[model samples]
Target: MPTPIQRVSERIAFAARTAFDRLPPEMVVSAFGVQYGHLSTAEGGDLFVTRLGWPMLDRLLPSQWYADGWYASHGSQLKGSTGNVYRVASRPAGGKSLDLVVKFSRMAQEVPLEVSTGFPDNVPPEVIANARFNSPMEEFGLVMELRGGGAAPELPRMLTQKPLAIYVPPETYQLWELGRSRSRFENHGHMLSRDQEHATKAIELDIRRMYVLVYGWIKGLDAEDAAEDAGLDAADLERLTVEVIAEMHERGFRVLDNKPKHFIVRPLRRGGGLLHREGALVYGLVDYELLQRTTEHQEAFWSRRRQIYRDLFRRRDEPSPASSATHLRPGRVFGVDYLYAETPDGGRVWTVGRNPGLFDYFLASRWHRTPRTKLSPRNEVYATRTRDGIDIVYRKSNVGVRPRADPFERRGRQIREHGYNSPFETVAIAEALRRKGIAATVPLAITRTGHHSGTARFLHDARRFRVHEPFRTPGAPAEPILIPDFDYYTLWASFGCSGQEAGATVDLETARARELLDDAEFKALAGQSRADLVALGIAGVPIANHEFLLSTDAAGRLERDARGKTRVALAMDALTAFEYQVLKEDRYQDLLRRISGQLGTLGVQKLDFSGNDVLVLLGLDGEFLAGPDGEISGTLCSFELMRGFEGLIGEPPEGVPGI
Candidate 1:
């Protein structure tokens, strides 16, 4: 008779098979774990089903499609490190045939554990933690990314199912106990006693639970088998292996194990032939457990590609000086490394990082070909789909322009008086604000139009734009280093929302505020909340409708927090507001009075009240309430005009007090 553990495993498997049969044909599932009595399986460890495999599961496992069907016949075991694999064959509903591979990650075996001690020879603690946490999910995620065409078409498709089914047996508890003990032993080598061999054997047998993975059977022979059958020499096999590895690197992946068995070679149409008609044999890789993108590969390939594109753009824009050697590379500025490139129009593109997805999307020719919406005479904006199918907005920076009769001309004057930050400075400020927990628009890249006068014009005068800063090397006294001016264009990101789009975001001034309050209604609010409004002004920030954005769900209703208040984040253009003024001077003075007593409490000395600088977080009932800190909770988005009180010491220079 079968043991109790075996009976329980069989029962769980039967329940899963029954559930799979009832699933609708259109429903697709991915990345689900199984839960049993006092036990839970990890993602990709239990079961995974992909979109393509959803309609075909029943056809793929006819015998196991129903409760009355015979149990699946397990075939010869295949080799694997973390799991055991077996060939599974079954007949379809109408006498069709199927061939599949089923992988079983049995819990009986002790998983290898890595414990870091901060020693030089050991792996870093973070790396070990990441490996432990990501091992189960990495393979599925990588395979999905590859299948989505994020990389080359040289990888296998994943047919994973969702909500992995759990299997609980009498031995499940024992398996857990053994696995934990073995992990402890492996992590702490000194814990092993003199009878290490007996302990190892005891740990091995206690493994019980198992995860199942199913994939469509590929019709091919292993590289070794193909080589032997085709009578290929060792040199030929080695050459093929090297070529495969090179292709993988080009596609942004590195295989941790490069064994010949990991590769499969399909036979040609002509029975005996192994090569394709084009004289090149195509092969696919299997076993994605150790597949990952390395930092070295990213820098060497993607980053280098970005540099090439940048150089090409620069070269097309203007001719390089015969005497000056131009090497396309990343330049360090303000503690940030920017990837430098020149555009075809003699413009310059300085990306914020070595390899940002934004650069790859915006710099592409397709984006340039897309029609642009002119928001202003000086600001041209474009919306296009990135490679990942995300909507992103790109607007030209309006630096170096002087506009007359502008409604906010006073604010413009203040900005000019304080010194206009270059595109680089803008990006730096955006990053700094984000670090301080202030919501703001994410800055992707900076593009500067070509010097109208030509590169030679700046050759002699470039030093004038360069700022001298103190720099000391070794024991020498501080010296000034000249930093040249590389004119920049506007920054870009997914607009009207945070960098990562979760849901729809609406402009506070035009869309949301109007929907929530009528002109007269807002006027009433101005009267009722005058004190609170003034308090906001005194907080040393401006309030603007366009500077803030409210997040909403798909239904267009505002998202709420636990306390039933509307949620908001700073918009990308929020920082562009540099002047301070409320719509009325009386309101501004009232705000100044409200915050005067707490002037030292506020991080900055001066307060700027414009119609657009901050967000007044609102409750569902439309009532304003103090945030957690007993002050009106406002989302301060801009730091452009905010300045420190010279008299204060040992305090942060920005943000609302107690925020």
Candidate 2:
């Protein structure tokens, strides 16, 4: 409805806004509410550009390359489906102009369910929908794998790929009416001829959206065209095609569409034959819409890779004296031993890098000799001494509980989806958090428990558990282990000052109130601790009073600052707490809403803070400077049940799971 000039002005403004940010902003707001404005196709579908792609594009193109300034002069349309392709001729600063192919993928594909399932009948509609939903990401994965040292099979080098943005057009009754009318009229003739049941579910169509990808343009012609120009016979072309297919499979990929057009062959030089001087033909494959590896293949490849990695680690570390033991195997590093044991009920145990003597003592007589503290109905905490005389805690992981009614049911469900983590996961997360400057208990070793004939029902999940293949014993059969239990060093050992003496530690709440009352500023904000607790409660986070432990020097008095003022303890029991006598009236919903909003602002989601999940550090003034916005500024000690956020590794390489 707007004039041409107005439309141009609008587009210019959009380009300016989007170009200002190096990577496109995730969302934008308009009269139609918030929408994804970045990384969309020319026809307004979803598109994604990867992190690696961004730097390459920036280096090769001008700053205004994404804007109308460069695009207007150098961008030309290329043939594609689901969305448009643009060949942008970009001239780098003082460099030659180069052509880059930018592909905008229609996010959804409507392939017949029959093709996906290989079944003519009884296919579920949801299967087709799910396939369409994952198609875009699947293609991205393939490109990423090739980029990350996977066999490329002479494919065009992918410069980078990323999700640009999601475009959801404003819903309108008119659009819905148009869709319904078209659906009915277009299928009318076919419906009249076919049976009602057959016609109803005859086709599966998805017109949802698209994503974007960028690749360095390959200089070549399609195999079909190149063969004709090069005077190659049908048999010669077929031989070349067969070679290409064999190479793709060798690299752990199976291309569903092996058409001649998808293969590109570079033109021979003048006076050169169709074949290279070395008698080899150079070609590349394209159009990876139906590319994937079978589940069995994936497991086998990863398992082999893991074994090679372990072998390398073993070779790198010096052989321990314990390696001489017949039943024991040398671990990946020195001072570590992999101890194997059989339970009384005929179950198996694989303990990682723990003292063999300590393992024997603990696993002896079904752990009956070890004393335990009942932390909760589901958790039993126990302590044991290693052969080296260092104490460690063994907490039983209650992985398979199906509670019918509980306040934490939602959180429990989320954790289950990621799998009930074993000691391996615990150690991996702890090490990762420590690297990120977050304080957490150290994981010493993992004990995998297998089910015996008389295993209890409560231990079913653990008994039937499969060890992460990477950590499994090499050459062992791929079988499920019993539940995995983790061992952790004591928290008090983390304290800097000498606090081993009795009565040298107190809860953080008591220490702060007792020591910081003299300072007016500290006294004024003393209620902040209570306020934080209220916020956490409103946010549906449950914590125990005993979790926060504060440690003092051997003098049994609060540590003093250089100015002689009392200093806060490092080992705090509770980050924040309130005295029962001064409890305030509950503002349940308001507090919950406020806490939820604050957590959302901090990008914390699907996280459970129950018990000792979070640790807060306090400054000399007795205040935790979590920032002016009261965002959570603390160490996340526990990662169990945390989801929807990046872990210490950030994004893993393609096909690799996060540790």
lDDT of each: 0.42, 0.41
TM-score of every model versus the real structure: 0.36, 0.35
The digit string of per-residue lDDT tens for model 2 on 1-659 reads 99665764465345444433342332222111112223333333322234433334333323324434354367876443224566676656346554566554433324433333432222246433434322334465665564443543354433222322222222223424323333433343232222112111121123321223455566677777777768877787767766765665555555554556667677777753454534666666666555555333353344333233223322322343554445544333112344554443334444444344324423423232333333224345454322222234555544443222344687656655454444444444555555544445544345433332233555345421432333444234533322334222112112221112224444443343344223453443344444554544423433332223344565546655687554332222232322121112242223334443444553545354532444444442345425355643444444444444344323332443442
Q: Report the Cα lDDT for residue 397, model 1.
A: 38
Question: Who wins the TM-score comparison?
Answer: 1
lDDT of 1 by residue, 1-659 (tens): 98665764554454345444454322222221111111112211222344445445444333342113222344455654345555555455556645666554332243354433422222335544444212232344555554443344445332222211222222254545434445533332321121122111111112344334455666687677787667677787777767766666556665554556767787665556475535667576766655666544443333333334433333332323343323233554444456565444445566666553334444533244343444333235555433223334565433333222234677555544443333444455555555555444555666554444233432233321332133211122322222333344444444453243334554343332325545664344334343444443424344444334556777656766797544544432211212222223554343334443333353542234433434343322323334465654333333334444322222212331311
Candidate 1 ranges beyond 4 A from true positions: 1-48, 60-74, 79-82, 106-137, 152-173, 176-209, 268-273, 296-659
